[model samples]
Target: MTGLHERHLAVSPDWLALYYRHPLELTHGEGRHVWDADGNRYLDFFGGILTTMTAHALPEVTKAVSEQAGRIIHSSTLYLNRPMVELAERVAALSGIPDARVFFTTSGTEANDTALLLATAHRGSNQILAMRNSYHGRSFSAVSITGNRSWSTTSLSPLQTLYVHGGVRTRGPYAELSDERFIKACVADLEDLLGHTRGVAALIAEPVQGVGGFTAPPDGLYAAFREVLDRHGILWISDEVQTGWGRTGDHFWGWQAHASSGPPDILTFAKGIGNGMSIGGVVARADVMNCLDANSISTFGGSPVTMAAGLANLSYLLEHDLQGNARRVGGLLIERLRAVGAGSPAVREVRGRGLMIGIELVRPGTDEADPDRAAAVLEAARAGGLLIGKGGGHNTSVLRIAPPLSLTVAEAEEGAEILGQALHTAT
Candidate 1:
């Protein structure tokens, strides 16, 4: 009866309750596992909502951070850090964007905000288009482009009207309208909006929707959108906050997942880039970046500490072939999940690519919402020593599992087995 829980006093409230967090207070993590204050270990399939990609306590990252902290930490934007420049160049080279200009930020939201502002500044346009159910970030400009209603408040400034595209329905998640039909609908919407709208700046999209249920746009969706943007003299911005850093597998840059579409005018990346080191960036063609005035700047965006961490994280990713690991483990995990869910009455669908997986739960006798069951599954998984998160438009049912790229095949199988048991208990 005497434990940490007993030592702590319960209060009505002091901290902001933004999310429904588990009762566990994580005290330490190593690799893909975390330990709560009570010393109970849990497999971190969630990876801090897809942030800790290189896993926790990576030796190289730790060493870099420690060294940088001892040498130099923060310096004004007026001065440049060697590590910052090196990391930027490495990112450009790895991303296959030759001579790409990089602007750093402390978080995904800030990176996205910078991208949006740069798009408008370069094109002298205000309107921006984003796909429905898309999540950009929480900053004002980024939130304005996000298509989710739950993330927005009533008092928020009016969103500039722009075209929304994709995510059509037919039968199931993958059985939706043909890829061709989906592309046509998207093109038509863009064309119509561009013809009537005053100044459309950018067409933004996720290579693979992250918070939007790990959904991938239909084939040709990106190419068609690129064509439409070119026709209207608009910029294409690929928001790879969650999908970048090899999470999608097969490529270093998430946008490469849709190479047929050609390169985006502006690309934003965060989350996995620094392996939870609070670094994000906007990489753009030199021409587009040059449009920004000399007045544009950030203070702590590319601090030495963060740059060192990023460099170490990037090195670890390449040296270990983490991208390849993601593909191999993700493929096996997907196959296993599909096999497990094939005949389950509670499973409505299992859809996703690479490590970004989503398991949708269905109501027993109806297509209606089933948030209760989803919550039950989440609780059961936590109790069973596994961690996962929820996503999707309705938030009714979606178990998002995006573990570290370093996660092994055996670990994936173990997580899946635990998930199966949790689902069985919940259902």
Candidate 2:
């Protein structure tokens, strides 16, 4: 290991994971490319797990952040920060929830934690419904509700969580069912689950399960579940940490795929939005948001600097129509990846929507997940000057591809070529 890597290992928590054998330190980034401490340039396909939404060091966001920093870095939540209020206003209007209220946090974990708080308080139930292979965040409550065993660290939590099925279409009990049948079966299963519990406060899910390998149920599955949840007065929470802000292309919010059921009662968003600045929040209708009786505030949330960054980032995204860009470019990228994966026996499935794509690796002609090959592919991709990510609910055997929304056609083609070569080499 390098000197910096050695120091990091000595000081950091053992559970803190780093990518690649050498563990590169990213020195700088612009658009879709980043340079390591060693000055090696590589195409950044993962975009720091999709946190860098628009682009690295976007001029608009950078200027806004710099200008805000000059004025004031932070003012505690006690004051009426103009930038904070502006950001909150924009987010509330776009939240899709009626009469929405927005509460800011520093990360997705805290966002979900707040969502859980609101949910349990409003419904007077600590029971939560989570999808199998779904991943939320990394806090006590968030981890408890996560259905992926690979990510969940403990069973101890304040809320009681029940795991539901139908997140992964190709590897579950209802895999063979037709789309219509699949929806019906999942709804029935949800009904059965609810009946067994005293009462569920909310059903939290990721429309595209991020750390669960971008696995997702067919569209309308959640809508069907919404139908059942409504009868019981249970709230639905969409964890849009990964699928929000048009990252999924076809819809603005991931739940829009299930629009038949209407917007979720509560929605949690983090990752992206402020570009690289830490920004997260929960949006809910006035009733659910106001349910909490006690006073609460996020000390570092919605500070002037971060709020300015968010406003600039959001304006750039909407003005440029990056959502449409994601739709057009992402459509081409998925097709290219599918064609590349077709000839590889190790590839069990190629799935996902928009810029978020996943290639599931398996033992050739076998059902077993091949995490070793996935690791090999990751290393090879890095060596080839391309950076990707790995994740899976079954195992860490899915290659995650999520580049910046501003990726050009040439960059997408180049990434595909490198990935195709890396996949074959890993075999």
Candidate 3:
């Protein structure tokens, strides 16, 4: 192993997984490509788990961070922070919550934790409803609401979490049902589950299940659930950590796909807003936000440097219309990938909207997941100068492709070609 790899193994937790048989140490990046410490360049399809929203080494974001660092790195939440306020304003305006209030955090875990806090306090209940095969974050509270067995490490939790169905449309019992019937069944399941509970604070879900291998329900599944949650006075919390800020391409926010019910009562976002900086936040109705009787603050949540990066990143994303690029290029990439998958017996599905895509791997002519093959494909892809990621519900059997929103058509096609070779070689 390399010296850095040996050192990482010594210092990192056993559960902190790394990609490839020999993990790579990326030294620097530009545009859609990154270079390893050994001077090999690769197309970064996973975007560091979708955190690099715009592109690698974006000049606008770098300049903002540098300028802000020169002035002030952080003043805590005690002092007036202009950049924090400005970024919050932009986020609030876009959050779609009426009379919205925004609270910043340092990571997606903290953001979800704050959302759960707000939700339970507002409703005076510690009961939460979550979708099966869903992943929110990695905090104690966040994990409590998580339904993915692979990610939910412990059974003990602070809240009473009820796992509902309908996150994955392709593997569950409802897979054979039509889209309309699937929505109806999930809604019925939700209503039935609620009949056995009381004082549910909120229903937290990802419009697109990220760690669950990019799986999603029918477009209106959440909209259908919204009607039931409203009757029970339960808040709907949309965890947009992976699907937020135009990453999904077709919509600025993934929740917009279920626009029939309007916005959620609360929305939590992270990963991409600040490009690579640490920035996560919760947006809620003013009344729900103020429901907390005690004052709370995040020390490193809205640091000036991070907020400046977020503002610059957001400006660049909007001005350049990266979302449009994601739609156009991602469409072609998915089509190309689907064509490639058509000939592979191990390939089960190529699914997603916009830039977020997943390719499931299974044993040839069988329904069983092939996590071993998935890992091999990951290694092969890296060997071919492409960096992708993997995730699934019960096992790591799906290849995830979520490049930066600014990916060009040429880059997409090149990456697809490399990936096709990887899939075949690994098989």
lDDT by residue (tens digit), candidate 2, 1-427:
8999999999999999999888999999999999999899999999999989999989999999999999999887998899999999999888889999999999999999999999999999999999889888899999999899999999898888998888888888999999999989888898888779887899999999999898889999999999899999999999999999999888888999999999999999998987888999999999999998999877899989999999999999889988888899999999999999998999999998989999999999899999999999999999999999999987899999999998899999999999999999999
Candidate 1 on 1-427: residue-level lDDT in tens? 3354434435434432322334567888999999987799999998887999989888899899999999988995789689989998887766666568998999999998888888988988777888777888877777788776656433354347464767423233334557776667667876887778877888888877777667776656777778877877889898989988888777767777568867788999988878879999999989898897778668989989999999998889989999899989999998888887775788877877778898877787676547788888888988888999887766547788899999999999998898888888988
Cα distance off (Å), candidate 1, residue 36: 0.5
List the candidates' TM-scores in order: 0.93, 0.99, 0.99
Candidate 2: C-alpha lDDT: 0.93
Winning model by lDDT: 3
In model 1, the Cα lDDT at residue 413 comes to 96
Query: Could you tell which candidate, 2 or 3, scores higher by lDDT?
Result: 3
Please report, in order, the local distance difference test score of every candidate based on alpha carbons: 0.80, 0.93, 0.94
lDDT-sorted candidate list, best first: 3, 2, 1
Can you tell me which runs of candidate 2 are displaced by over 4 Å? none
lDDT, residue 322, candidate 1: 92
Clashes of 2: 0
Task: Estimate the lDDT of model 3.
Answer: 0.94
Displacement of residue 103 (Cα, Å) in model 2 is: 0.1
| TM-score of model number 1 | 0.93
